[model samples]
Target: MQRIHNVTQLADLDDDAMARCYAYPRQLDRPWVRANFVSSIDGAFTVDGVSAGLGTDADHRVFVLLRELAEVIVVGAGTARAEDYGGAHPDPARRRAHFQRGIGGSADGAPPPIAVVTASARLDPAARLFTDAEVAPLIITTAHADPDRVAALQEAGAQVEVAGAAAIMPAAVLRVLAERGWQRVLCEGGPHLFGQLAEADLVDELCLSTVPKLVGGAGGRISLSASGFDTPMSRKQLVLAEDGTVLARWARR
Candidate 1:
């Protein structure tokens, strides 16, 4: 791995940066998925208890760009709670880009929906994830969640549905989104969710921003517990941005 100091280095690169280093090809059609994350040099998911510390100006720009390209943004409930994320509407400039790219914008006019995966139905109804956007949030949960809570979220203007049991199974969630015409899903993860998706063979690409600093703590990692997989998963070469970040894509063999 190399450390990149500027985004200019990636200006001339093509999809190879996303494909060769991240393992995602531009040729993928519906049901295509990607995991976007940023990490410290030492592999910590956070510093001072926040992920914003790991992001650079270029990283944030790239993150927004990725969001603009996605049809729907999928996130684990824990990540949503931690980050206090709202809807998935790109900013004005990015929204225009999305419209040009054939994403998020109907002739009638509607923004893209944000998908939050949770097993527990205990999230706060007044959270930013529900209040921050014009469009209603989509809460994807398992059968184990509380019925009353689900109804409550629904009443609060969220589209709540039970998609799987135990954990929010990635394959099941992807199938549901695919049915709704959400062919390209972007997962902004919080580690555990990334692990679950990878274990289920649902992740097709990984967009990683490698930060320059390092946090030596043992608190959080770029991935969650590894108990679900029967064996280790492997990755394929994708693209390497000029800033030293890498994009990798992988699939089940």
Candidate 2:
């Protein structure tokens, strides 16, 4: 990968450099919500019904790197189901990278747990999220969710927590994760969840990868909020790949 704009002019960026560029702040006392997402050049977040088709090799690399940097990943239930979500896996190299950056690693060297936000608590108990996870997922749902479904998820070994009454609120989700000492929070969002977080001004940073393709279909943008609001962002970093993919990082201003 190469950094083409607003940088120190590195023609080629190696793995270590890339990790260094994307590392979370070493000192974080509160949950810093960083959202990672991919979309087409025309602003379509997905090609067909799934987002997997919009990803490139460069995008995938950054996706994994973001996962490595985070303490917990938050996603909407619709996204988790559509993407066939799984738990983050432990990366020894990333742990060492964190240590080199003076940011302590997980004591057990375990992967970050995924926190799924759902209003109805309608996740599959037998899904790969539960059965094939390196760490147990935290199911964040509303208090009014179906009792039987909540009990079923708990029975399947998930840590289910109530974050709201009738709906899942973004601030409450952050509070829940913050209480668990998950300071570096990453949200792999479906648009609605991203919208809510942005609306609540809970989002701190955005790591967006733009694929070079153009899908002018009935697709959605990276965020879908109930009402429009403006939150200015400052470009932090920009990188380009050989395949024409552009990855950029934006910080809330």
Candidate 3:
């Protein structure tokens, strides 16, 4: 992979080098919050109700790199359900790269945990996300969430927590994650949760994969901004693959 705008050449960009490229910032005032998403050149976030249609081999590579670097993976229940999320299985190659770079997880070096956001408490108790987790996931919801459903989920072995009363609050979400030492948060989103995070001005970085296709469908943009709350972003790096897929890193400004 090679950078385009600045024209920086990378020799193969092997796993170790890639890990260094996206290593979590050393000094953070609070937990470092980042999001990853893929879209077509025309800005279609998905096709056929999923993001799989607009991806390339390189995109998949970056996806794993981002997830491997995170301390916890955050996602809206919609995206989790749509994608049928399960345990983040161990990646031996990534583990080696992380060890070489000395940017890996805790001493135990286990797979990062998953924290899910839901307002309705309707996630499946038997879903592989719960049944196959290496570490139990954190289910975040509102105080107004369905008590019976939450009880059912608890019975199924989930750490359920209430983040707000009428709705889930983004600041509270980060606070909860921080309280648990999950500083590097990766939010793989559905637009509603993305909108809320943007509204809260909590996103620290966005790793976007712009595929080289034009999928003409009803798909929408990667995220919707809050009304009157425009968060400026500065491009930090731009890498272009041989297949015309562009992977970009943008810091919130």
Candidate 4:
């Protein structure tokens, strides 16, 4: 890792090195909410209708590290479907080191689970997110969500939990995650979910990777919302990879 002012932040990206880079918060009152995203230099979060275009080896490396440190990866259903998110296939060495190194406060030793937030529970029953899950993909919904669809998801192998009444509330989502004993919440977003977190003032950190490319067209930016805020941020780390992928870490201020 390198500092924004050309100072050497770190010398390597080895296991120990990366682990230290993404170490979870030392102390917490509640779950620490963090989000990860990749974007183009033009401020586009998605290209060709997805976020895959704005990715690089370095960004992916950091992505894995963040997941390794998190105890529960919270994501919007739309992003999960778009990214083809299956169960976490954690690296054996990485998973082992995470426990041994004590990344976050887990009740017992286990890789983080994926908790997907959705209103309709329309995810496919056979989707790898469920069938091939390492940990059963948790389905978060509202009481007012379609009950029939909820039953379908429950039959589909998801542990459905009602977190709200009509619309999915951020606080309710956090309550469900905490009930599962997760203290580190990693949110991989698709705008809607991110906006909700922002609206509720729940975002603690953001890991953004800037790919060195220009994708000029109609595409989603990092944020899309009816509710927006001029939130202040503190730069925690700024590293320029050899491939010019600028990986930045910021804390909400």
Candidate 5:
């Protein structure tokens, strides 16, 4: 173990610089799960029952950049419900960076699709995830989920697939993405989902922004699992924003 010292201020990083900093590995044969989350100094990932309440402008900037870097965004149904998740809407700058990576997009430069993981397949068909999407959403659920609900989502324009028998397996989800050539995977979590991926050893990288605040409440941690395990990770990058938000990138060691 080594002490981290001599850190420098990293402020006003231009679009290109931010993209370069968060770019996925150049060559990837399989899905590389990268989770992006914002947390308070006291380990609270949410305030007033939503994560957006915990993020600052600096954190939101990195969040958008990370979304541009990913080919697919995965989220838990619970998070999707809480955040009222919608399809990705990449701005011109983000779209340009996305295509510059040699990843072809739709004629109108649609952003990557959001894939929702749910065991119950309980999602709103009228939600923005389906209505406001340029690309159709992908729904990954278990075979035992209510067939009617699964069919409802399928009818609502989601490409539904069964990835598990009774639960949504992390490996199965990655396999589905890998088969579709989605190598750069980004997961926006609601804690429980992050816990599953971490437990399964499927998480490759984590981009975390430490918001400068102390929200003392019953907010849970950034990850939750029935059991706990340790996977050593090395800090890949550290950027201190002027607004006091600290952006950190960590990779499994």
Candidate 6:
């Protein structure tokens, strides 16, 4: 992993450091999209593992702002399981801002839908995700998943669908999103999902939040592994944003 001391070192930053961090790629006009994540100096996505504890006051503000801009939030099942994700409900102030922009509904309305990608259909419905968030959940699965299991989630009111024959393919997921008229999709990942997306050439941009501290553990890293391409599949540049966070944008060739 690359390390930098401060946010100013990034070359592409704009006046509102937050806006620059979430800027979309020019090539990604619709359907496909990207967002990045990073941690704070403590080497925690949270104080433990949740995202809520990773940022400064400014960082948290920008984090919510990014969610407001996205039409859907895509996350791997492991992340959903670990984080106990409920939905992509932005704060009331941010929701109002989205309403002004005609993206979200009134305060009483539901938040943006969440797309959960999983290889197996069997997951704990009692997991904090379903019980906590108000928005309905969308499950993307493979044909390998059990039909009865899918039915259970459906009975519980989730919208479940098969996206690939064996494992969920990034391309098929994007196609499904396009069909639903979801143009801006934000992917919050565990390393495995990030590796799959990067290898499949599905990601358009990244909003990495590079924290200052490091934990030399065998488990955590920005990516699981590099792609097996004979040549480079893409290139990225970093931009320094608020509170020692670095946003890295990668465009796939």
lDDT of 2 by residue, 166-193 (tens): 9977889999999898988889998999
Error of 5 at 206 (Å): 0.8
Give the candidate order by descending lDDT. Answer: 2, 5, 3, 4, 1, 6
Q: Write the per-residue lDDT of candidate 3 for residues 16-77, one digit (tens) a residue.
A: 67777778876565888889999999989999989999879889888888878788899999
Question: What is the per-residue lDDT of model 6 for residues 88-108, given as tens digits with 9 covering 90 to 100?
Answer: 777656555555545432344
Question: Residue by residue across 80-130, what tens digits does model 1's lDDT show?
Answer: 887888886665554554455454323333456788889986778888877
Candidate 4 vs 5: which has more TM-score = 5
Model 3 stretches astray by more than 4 angstroms: 1-11, 96-104, 225-228
Give RMSD to native, each candidate: 4.8, 2.6, 2.6, 2.6, 2.6, 5.3
Write model 5 residue lDDT over 82-170, tens digit each, in one string: 88899998775656645667442223456889999999999999999999898899999998999999999999999998999999778
- Clashes counted in candidate 5 amount to 0
Q: Candidate 5 or 6, higher TM-score?
A: 5
- Using TM-score as the yardstick, the better of models 1 and 6 is 1
Error of 3 at 178 (Å): 0.4
Comparing 1 and 3 by TM-score, which wins? 3
Question: Which 10-residue window of candidate 3 scores lowest in summed lDDT?
Answer: 3-12
TM-score of 6: 0.75
**Candidate 5: TM-score?**
0.93
lDDT of 4 by residue, 77-165 (tens): 99888888787765656666776666752434456788999887777877888777777789998887778888878887889998777
lDDT of 3: 0.83
RMSD of 3: 2.6
lDDT of each: 0.70, 0.86, 0.83, 0.80, 0.85, 0.65
In terms of TM-score, the best-performing candidate is 2
RMSD to native, candidate 2? 2.6
When 1 and 4 are scored with TM-score, the better candidate is 4
TM value for model 2: 0.94
Which of the two, 3 or 6, has more TM-score? Answer: 3
